[model samples]
Target: MKLKKNITLGLFISASVTALAWQQSGKPESFAVNGNLSGFNDSIVYLTYGTFDDTKIDSAKVTDGKFTFKGRVEEPVQGMLFSRDYKLRLDLFVDKGAVEVRGATDNLKVAGSAIVNDYALFNQEIMANRKWVNNIFTEAWNAKQSGDTARARLLEADGNKWYAYEYEIRKNYIRQHPSSPISARELLMYVNNKTLDECRPMYEALDAKVKASLQGQELTRRMELLSKIKTGNKALSFAQTAVDGQTITLNTYKGKYVLLEFWASWCGPCRAENPNLRKQMDIFGSKGFNVLGVSLDKTRDPWIKAIEKDGLTWTQVSDLKGWNNEIAVAYGVKAVPANFLIDPSGTIIAQDLRGEALNQKLKEIFK
Candidate 1:
C-alpha cells in the first residue's frame, strides 16, 4: 500500500497540506456506524481525518449503538474506527462518502459522544500536536532572547525530549500498524538521523520486530537489504534453478571473480549493458573473471529470446520464479540493471558497473 505523510513538527500548520476528505469528494457525506458502543446517545459518532484541523472528534450522537458522520470531500478518502491498539477494526476507502458503519463498533463499549464536523478543525487539532512540540523550541528561543544561558540549556533539553516523544510515537505506530509504509519510513528516518539510540533495547527490539514482519515481503525486504548491502563487505549466497532444470548455487563460483548481473528481457537499459558485459567477458574469460547473469523475466520465452537477442554468452541462471525469484531475494535486487562485481576472494568490489567503466576495471585486473 502507498503511504503518505503530510505533517511534521518542525513545520507550521499553515504549511501543511490538507487531507483529502470523502465528504468533499462528491461520494457520500453521510455515514451511519452501528456496533455495541454504549453510553452517550447511540446515534453519536466520532470522526477523524475529516477536516483541515487536528482534533480527531467531528460530531456525533449515540443511539441504538449507531452513529453517523455527514461531510463530503473528493476522491480517495480513507476512514476507520478502531478500539485501543486496533483490537477491533473498521476501515474504508471512499472516492465519495456515503459509508455505513454497522459493524465498526459492534462489540466495543465506549462512553461519551464523538463528532468530527469540520475538516479544518481536525487539521487544526493535529497541528496542535506540532505546536506542542514547537513550544519546547520556543522556550529555548525565549531563553536565548533573555540572555539566560542556564535557561537556554534547560529549554534545549526540553526540545530533545519532544524529539524523543515524536520518535517514540512514530515507532509505536509502526509497531501497531506493521504494514504502514509511512510509519516504517518515519522510523527509518529517525534511525538514519541517529535520533533513535542504537544501544537502546527499544531500538533493537523494534528493528527485530520489523525485520521479522517484513521477512517475506519481497519489495520491503529487498529495499532494506539493498540499503545494507552497499555498506557491507560480506558475500551473499543464493540458489536458483538453471534453464536445464539443474539447481545453481551462487557459491559455486567461489574460487573465481564473479560479476552478478541482474537484468530483464524488457529492459532496454539492461539490453544496452549486455554487449558491454559480453565484451568484458570476452576479454576476461581466460582470466579468473566470470559472469553470472540472473534475469528477472517471468516467462521462459522472452527470457530465452532476450538472451539470444542480446548475445549474452555467460552462465545464465534463473529459477523461472521471475520477480519472486529466490536468488533475487537473497541478493536484495529490487530493480533490473543492477549488479555486483566480486573479487576472487568473494568480497564485493563494486556495483552497478556500466559502459567503459566496466571494461576499464576488467582491463586493469585481467590485462
Candidate 2:
C-alpha cells in the first residue's frame, strides 16, 4: 500500500517536472484531452495537473457523452481525469498534442504521447500483479481468522511468492527501458525497497534526458543522502529544540555512546518497543551511554504523553513535522522505530537495533 502511494507520487513528480521545465523556458505547449465517457453524461469531469505538493485543477462539464479539456502547458505534465462524484478516475500524461480517452467511465483508456502510453501500460501491469497478490493476502487473512493455521500458512507463502514475482517484473522493466521516464519513475518508487548498489546501475543507464528530469534530480539527491549514512560514516550533525524547550545538538553527546532513535507516537511498533528501550537506558545511562530520541510526531502533546507513559527519561527532541522531520530525513529514515548506534567518536557503529539486539550490542560495548 505504501509502495502504491509512493509510485503515484513519483509519477506525479515526474510529470510536474516536465511542466515546470516548459514554464521556465517561456515556451508554450498545448494539450487537448478528448474524453468520451459512456454512462456519464451531464456530469462534471476534473483535470488536475502538477506535482503532489502543488497542483492546478480544471473542470469540464460532460455533455452529450463527451468532455474536452484544451489547455497550454509549459511542457508535458501528468494529470488526472476524474468525475465530480469521485467514481471514475484516470491518470493521464498531458503532452503537446491531441490525446484521446474513450471507454466505459470505469474503465478509461489513454492514448497520446509515447511516454504517457508507456507509463499507462506499466501501471496497468503493476496493478494487475498487485491485485493478484492482494487477493492471496485476503484469503490468507480469512484462513487465519477461521483458525485454519496450515491453510493460512500456505496462502501466506503464495502471497509472498506473487509479491516477489511482481518485484522482479518491475525491476526487469526498469532495466529494459532506461530511456523511458517510466523507468526512472519505477526506480524512484523502488528506492526504499532496493539498495543504492542495486539502483545505481539502472539509474546510470537511464537516458540523459530522463536523468535530468525533476524526479531524477530528487532521486539523485536521495541516493547521495543515503550514501552518507552507511554504518561506517560519521553521524550527521543536527540541532533541534527538545520537548522541554531547550536547545539540543548532536555534538552535545560527543563523549558518550549515543543511540540516535527516530520514532513517533503514531507508530505502534515504536510505542511497543518503548519498554525495551527504557530498560536499555536504565542499564546504560550511568555507564557513559545515552539515547537521543527524535520524535516524528506532528504535535507535542501526544509525543510528551507517550514519552511519559513509556518512562523514556532520556534526551528527546522533535520539530513535530511527522514524516518530514528534518533529522530523520537527513538520516534517510523512511520508517519509524529506526535508530543509529553511534560511538563516542560520533561514528555510526550499528543501525536499526531493536528488542534483544539492542541490549546485546550495548552489553558488548560496555562489558
Candidate 3:
C-alpha cells in the first residue's frame, strides 16, 4: 500500500509540473533556425494547411545558412520548417511560446532540443524519433528510385511506425504530465490503435472523474477514428449517387471484388492512371471486379467533368464534402490516389494498383 501510494504521488507531481508549464503559457515566443546552406542565399519558407494544398510562404528570409524566427504563434499550431521545394519538416509544437532549432533538419532530424521550455522535454524525444523515421523514409525513397523494390518494401513495411512509437513515448510522458492536453491526446491516439481488449483497462482508469476533465478537440476526433478502425464496426455502408442518378452502396457489390478508390478531380496522378484503369476495367469489370470512386472534391461540375474527361465510366460516388467528408474519416483517408482492392469475399487483397502492375493483375485475374 505504501509503494502504491508513492507511485500515485509521483504521478501527481509529474502531472502538476506539466500543467504548470502549459498553464503559464500565452506568452510571446521566438525560434532561432540555424543550419548550413551549401550555396543557396535566398530561401522561402511556408506552412501547409493540409497535406495537399499550395505552399504559402508566410515567412521569408535570406540565409547565410542560418535564420531566426521571432514571432508569436497561437496554441495548437504545429510548427513546420521548410526550404524552397526541398522538404517540409514538422519541427516543433508551439502552444504559445518560442521553441528553437539549432541545426540543419530535414523531415528526419527536425525534432532536436535546441530551443524548448524546461518542463516538457518534448523536443528531445521528438528529435530522436524524427531521426529514426527520417532514416526510414530516405532509405525507402532511395531504394525505390534505384529499382530495389525488395529493399524498399522491407524499409517501408509500415507507413506508421512513428505513430506507434509515439504511443509508448506518450504513455511514459503522461505519467509526468497528466494535465497536458497534447500528451493526453497523444496517449489516447496510441491506445485507440490497440485492441479493445488491450485498451479496456486504460479506458477504465479514467472511468468517472478524470474522463470528463480531459477535453481534447483534435485529440477527440483522432481517438474516435482509431477506435472505429480498431473495432472494424462499419459506421455506415458506403453509399453515394451514381452519375446516372442511381443510388449505390458499397455493400451492394459485397460478394464481388471491389476497389474503394479515394481520388480527386485535380489530381494529376489520378488522371494519368485513368487510362490504365479503363483498360483494366474493360478486362475485369465483368469478372467480379468493380471500382467505387470517392471523390475528394467540393464542387460537382469539375468532379463530373473529370470523370468524362478521363472516360472513367465506373460507379463514382462522393458526398461532395471534400476532405472533411465523413467517409474519409471513417476509412482514415489522408492522401489522394489511395485505393484498397477487396477480394471477392470483401477482404482487402491488394492496394494502390497502377501502371503496368495493374494491367498485369487484370491479365492474371481475367485470364
Candidate 4:
C-alpha cells in the first residue's frame, strides 16, 4: 500500500483594496491577507483556495519582504500558499476578513481568523509528529542498510507506534472540536484507513455546519461510494484501456475467480509483491483463477518496464492518470497493492489478500 505523503500547507496575506459582496457566518464582506516572510524576498507566492476537487488559484509577487492577496469567498475554505520553487508552503482556513501571516518562511504564524488558528494549531501537532516518524524511518533504513535487523525492526515498530499515536491525536482532536473546520478535515484523513462502521459515528458527531462544508461533502461522497463496495457487495463494474490499446471491462473476466488488483510502478511495496502475486497466478491460472491488474501509473514507459521485469503475465489496464486513475477512483482505492478477490459470479469474497494469505485462500477456495 502507498504510504502517506507530506501535506503542503500554503498560506497568503493581503491588504484590502475593495470589498466584494459575499456572506458567511460571522465573516466579513471581503477578505484581505498580509504576509511577511523573513528569508523569501523578491519571490512570487501562489495562493489556492477551496477543496481538492474545486479550487481557485492566484499568485502575487513578494515586495519588501511581504505579499498580499484580497478576495471574497462565500464561506471559510481551505487555502494554501506556496513559493515558486514549492519549497515553502503554508496551509490555513480562509474566509472573508483581515487575515495576517507572518514569521519565518518555514514556520508561518497565522492570525485574525479563529478557524485558521484552529487549523494551524492542529497542523502544528501533526507536522511535529510526522517529523518524528520520519526520523524513525530514516534510522530504520540506516539500520537495514547496515544489516542490523534487530535495530531496524525496533525502529520500524517505533515508527508504526508513532503513526498510530498521531492518528489517535487527530481522532481525539476531531472528537473534541466537532465545530472546528479542522475536525472535518481530520475526519477525511481516515476515510481510507477506517471502515464505514468505524467512521460513521465520528462523522455523525460533527456539527451540522462542519458536515456541510466542502471537505465534509467530499467525505460524505466517499462514504456513499464505500458503502456500495463492502465485503458482501458485488465488485463495482468499470472499464479501462489495456496496455495493448484495447478497452477492457471487469465483466470480461466474469467466468473466473478474479483478483482485481490496484498497483503502480513507482510504489515500492507494489513492486515487491509482484513476484509473489505472479507465483499465485501460476499455481491457479489453469484452474480458472485470473488477475485483472489496474495500474495507477502516470506514464506508460515505467509501467511497461515493470510488467516485463516482474513477469506479470496477467491482463493489465490503466488510464495513466496516477492517483486519479478512473478505475482506481471508482473502486475507492486509496493505496497501491490493494485488491478485491471476486468469485466466479462477481461477488467480492475477500480483499487485500497478499503473499501466503493469498495462496492459502485460493487453496481453500479451490480445494
- Model 3 whole-model lDDT (C-alpha atoms): 0.57
Model 3: residue 159 alpha-carbon error in angstroms: 14
Question: lDDT tens string, model 2, 259-322?
Answer: 9999998899998998888898788889998988999999899999998888888989999888
Q: lDDT per model, in order?
A: 0.56, 0.77, 0.57, 0.79
Candidate achieving the largest lDDT: 4
List TM-score per model, in order.
Answer: 0.46, 0.74, 0.54, 0.78
Task: Name the lDDT of candidate 2.
Answer: 0.77
> Which is superior by lDDT, 3 or 4?
4
Residue 185 in candidate 3 has what lDDT?
43
TM-score computed on alpha carbons, candidate 1: 0.46
The lDDT of model 4 is 0.79
Which lDDT tens digits does candidate 3 get at residues 1-367?
Answer: 0111111212322334434334323443443433343344556554432111222235656566555555443233334566676454544444443344444443233332222242235545645565666667677888899999987887787435663664555565555554444443444445533343555444444323224322333444555665554423433366677667787876778788777788899999888888877877788888878888889988999999999888888888777899876667677666678776666565555556778877777677668
Which candidate model has the greater TM-score, 1 or 4? Answer: 4
In candidate 2 the C-alpha lDDT for residue 88 amounts to: 84
**Candidate 2: regions farther than 4 A off:** 1-106, 145-147, 266-272, 282-289, 297-299, 309-311, 320-324, 334-337, 353-367
Residue pairs with colliding backbones in model 2 are 22-74
lDDT of 4 by residue, 190-251 (tens): 76623678888889987777777667788888888888887778888889999898889878
Better of 3 and 4 by TM-score: 4
